[model samples]
Target: MEAKLWFILLCSVVALLLYVIGFWRRKAGEAAFAAARAAATAEDRDRYCRLAVMAGHREACKMFCLARSDFFEDHRPLEPFKSHGIKVVFYGYYYPSRYTDLLNEEQRAFCRSLYQFKEGENHGIGFFKACMSALKLDDAPYHIMFMPCSDEFKYARRFKRLDWYIRTHRKGRTSGLYDVDVFEPRDSLHEAKGGENRILERNYRITGDIKGKQVIIVDDVLTSGQSMADYKEEIERCGGKVVAAIFYGKTVSVPPMLLVKAVVWGGYIKTG
Candidate 1:
């Protein structure tokens, strides 16, 4: 039909436009990165940072926004959650390449100061509290669980304690309104396979029973949604209804070459 043909043509044109814009943005980003590297001085680097944004380098813009603690507040997690029977939310984005990995000592110090991690700070609890308040679940009793991370990640260990803190500290004085428990998996996927499917095998076995329980999954980041998808499938299998999921950040893909060069350049600039 003529309508089908028109639809296809429209989609093709839109795809082509997106491709052209992406190519232009990447080229501009590269030029800006090169200029920033050559500039060496703080004032010169700052000037190049503005140029990168003006040139439409999204990554550069992310870095500038991150440094100022203003990450464009336009991330959407709802679309990814539509397929699965779950709701997910994220507070902010963790940059693909941290400034410390791409800048000199002075720059690194400045960047560190911008995003400082104080001792005894648990971002998960903070986000959880905010989520509870926003959802107006002050009087509702619920259970919390964690999507297991690699053993090497500090977040994994921190959650073990944070889980306890939430159950004990976040509880209400009223008996029915404050009951909380944190679930853990005996095993978890350590890594993801490469290529199209990016298939991940479920290595987790829930340590506790959650028959007819309302559960929420807390994670540090949501990458491909594969891990969480697997988590939801397994949790539902155990009769636990997943109401929502919360994450500290969402993962954004970055060019592998840029990441490698950032580390190399950071080391070289530091020594010089």
Candidate 2:
């Protein structure tokens, strides 16, 4: 009886060991499969999956198309301005990498034809010109507003540089200059000792009358749309109707609430 009991115990131990090993192998295989599936999904979503890293512009257009399609499925597609009798405007920044050097000789010339500012001009001048061109309102009588979301002090330094440059180079042209506006949502909340979870308040100050006017909010990149959302809220609060929001580049993830009217991509190739 004692020998039989010992034999039974040994067999039980062997069985338990085998079961544990098999269980571990199965778990590992499942985990590996899950990881592979996740990777494949991510690759499918990424426009630059098979393309080289430097070919960002080429991939950016594809990503924009995908995002546009996704956006249209959930929300109404942007109607043509001609039908609505709405004024079309374009706003953008002068990214040298995007227009000047990114293209071949012919393409570079073509972009230059549309470019108002000269090559290697101050960034602020380029930005102002680009905004005017984008809006299609170069000759139209309208107020210009500058709403920089950056820190006041940091932007103050840039403004000072621009101020000195403008005063020295283009005298008398700085009179009707940007109605300066600042949006410091993050920093303001941080200073108040607000927790990270606290929703930041949208603060805005408008120099001109925005009531019953169609406004076009312009930005460089369309990311989480949080900044745009804040801007839209403030603009509406100040009685300005946002006709459209234009962006130079559109990222993969954009918030649904912030509707993007138009996006221009593939205008730049990352040489670096």
- Give candidate 2's whole-model lDDT: 0.41
Which predicted model would earn the best TM-score? 1
At residue 37, candidate 2 shows an lDDT of 27
TM-score of each: 0.54, 0.36
User: Over the full model, what C-alpha lDDT does candidate 1 score relative to the true structure?
Assistant: 0.55
TM-score between candidate 1 and the true structure: 0.54
Best by lDDT: 1
Q: Give the distance in Å from residue 185's predicted Cα in candidate 1 to where it truly belongs.
A: 11
**What is the per-residue lDDT of model 2 for residues 1-272, given as tens digits with 9 covering 90 to 100?**
99999999999999999899877755554444334323434444332321311222333333333334454332221221221233322222122332232223433443343231212232444544443445554332232223343455543443444455545654332311244455453353212332224564545456566776655554443334555566667767878765555443332333332222122223223321
Q: Candidate 1: list runs displaced more than 4 Å.
A: 1-47, 53-83, 98-123, 136-138, 151-156, 172-197, 253-272
User: For each candidate, what is the lDDT?
Assistant: 0.55, 0.41
